[model samples]
Target: MDRYVRSTRRAGGFTLIEVMVVVVIIGILASIALPAYQDYVRDSKRAEAKAALSLVAQRMERCFTESNTYVGCYGGATVNSDSGNWVVSITESAASYQLEADTSAQHSDGECDPMTLTNTGATSPAACW
Candidate 1:
């Protein structure tokens, strides 16, 4: 009877080793998932920046069609990407323009940081565009 009772009590709950093993498995899965999730977020932000850049360029084109110049295309005001992840700065001349999307948040992303677009329909840091 004692043996039966002892066996029943032992089986009623998980052992420390079992709990530890489960914890380790969870940790491993999290370690793998966390970085992948971060990468996805970063990529999405980049895509947003790219789209914002394109939209700004399109707006500039429309302005140029009306005014025949690029100087006042963006209205001489500060611009930020739609998602607020990038700040857009324009370098313009009478006939040409360059748009730069810069942000401290993406500074660590050397390969894609400071994405650029030109009036000639060119994009820099080719891997990012």
Candidate 2:
């Protein structure tokens, strides 16, 4: 009688099905993570814009206190956020002023694209502020 022995060697690498499963998992994770990250970045940019608007509003108030007008305030400083994420535009009269912060690029911020603040400490789109 002859005895048979079983082969001990096995394939060392992953099979096609295993590799495909891993790829699918990675893709799913990325799909979820990418959107969350983008949203976080947009929200941070909006926060920066809000801060810039507040600082400008303060400067306007100071100008009114000293010169009794909001015109030509900020000492001719550039009307943009330090990060360049926002472009500020001012509309002012002798007593009151409005500062609007619009996105500097095409990054659409559907929630609050143009944030507004006034010299009287009022902010628009109350949910955002």
Candidate 3:
């Protein structure tokens, strides 16, 4: 008796090539998403820094109004204030007065400066204040 042999290959769930293609697609999607997510994080951090800085600016203004003196650059000098993670500093040179907020959480030894709180202005990543 002769036996019949099946020669056609069956369709499986996924092949190696298909799996690899899916992985590559996912990788490409992640690569596109990561930078946008990072930018969002930076923007949120910057917003926090700005809000903290605004509060500090108001406080500095009040201090100035009450004592009638230009407050100098004070770094993280707030004691028992609402702004727990901020270093509020005011610097007045000859004409303009600048209020800066430095972040306690993202405080870098070299890059973390109150005046540079927004990390190279509105174009770069932001530090948490």
Candidate 4:
């Protein structure tokens, strides 16, 4: 009679500890990337505010040149950007004007909540611009 011997061996597969390590690595990467992505989005939205302010300032300048005054320019109304991400308004006089972009309502988390531009083309919160 011939006798057969049985051998015990485990199948190849990922262990729970290995899987957990991979999940932890992914979580760490996500935590690092999420804040960066949010900041990028906020910065891009800020560009919209800056551009809207610039456009309004140009119109105000043209109105001043034509009428010798800033009155009635844009009808003293707040103008919104095409994307509606920013609200732009101007405070003007015969000699000077200040344009502001208010992002509080649309983008409250933005680092530069409110940006300002002057007739002289000066931008505020200097780092943002």
lDDT of each: 0.84, 0.83, 0.54, 0.82
lDDT tens digits by residue: candidate 3, 13-67: 9898999999999999999999999777656655666666666556555655676
Which candidate comes out best when scored by lDDT? Answer: 1
Which TM-score value belongs to model 2? 0.85
Please provide, for model 1 over 20-114, each residue's C-alpha lDDT reduced to its tens digit, 9 standing for 90 to 100. 99999999999999999989987987888788888889999998999999887775555887657788888888999998888766445667888
Model 1 spans with C-alpha error above 4 angstroms: 1-11, 105-108
Q: Candidate 1, overall lDDT?
A: 0.84
TM-score of 1: 0.86
Residue 122 accuracy (lDDT) in model 3: 32
Query: lDDT: which is higher, 2 or 3?
Result: 2
Of 1 and 3, the candidate ahead on TM-score is 1
User: What is the lDDT, from 0 to 100, of the residue 21 in candidate 2?
Assistant: 100
Arranged by TM-score with the best first, the candidates are 1, 2, 4, 3
Clashing pairs for predicted structure model 2, backbone only: none
Which lDDT tens digits does candidate 2 get at residues 1-129? 235776689969999999999999999999999999998998798899889998888778878889988777754445978978788888887778888888855766777978899877888778788
Alpha carbon lDDT of residue 39, candidate 2? 83
Superior by lDDT: candidate 3 or candidate 4: 4
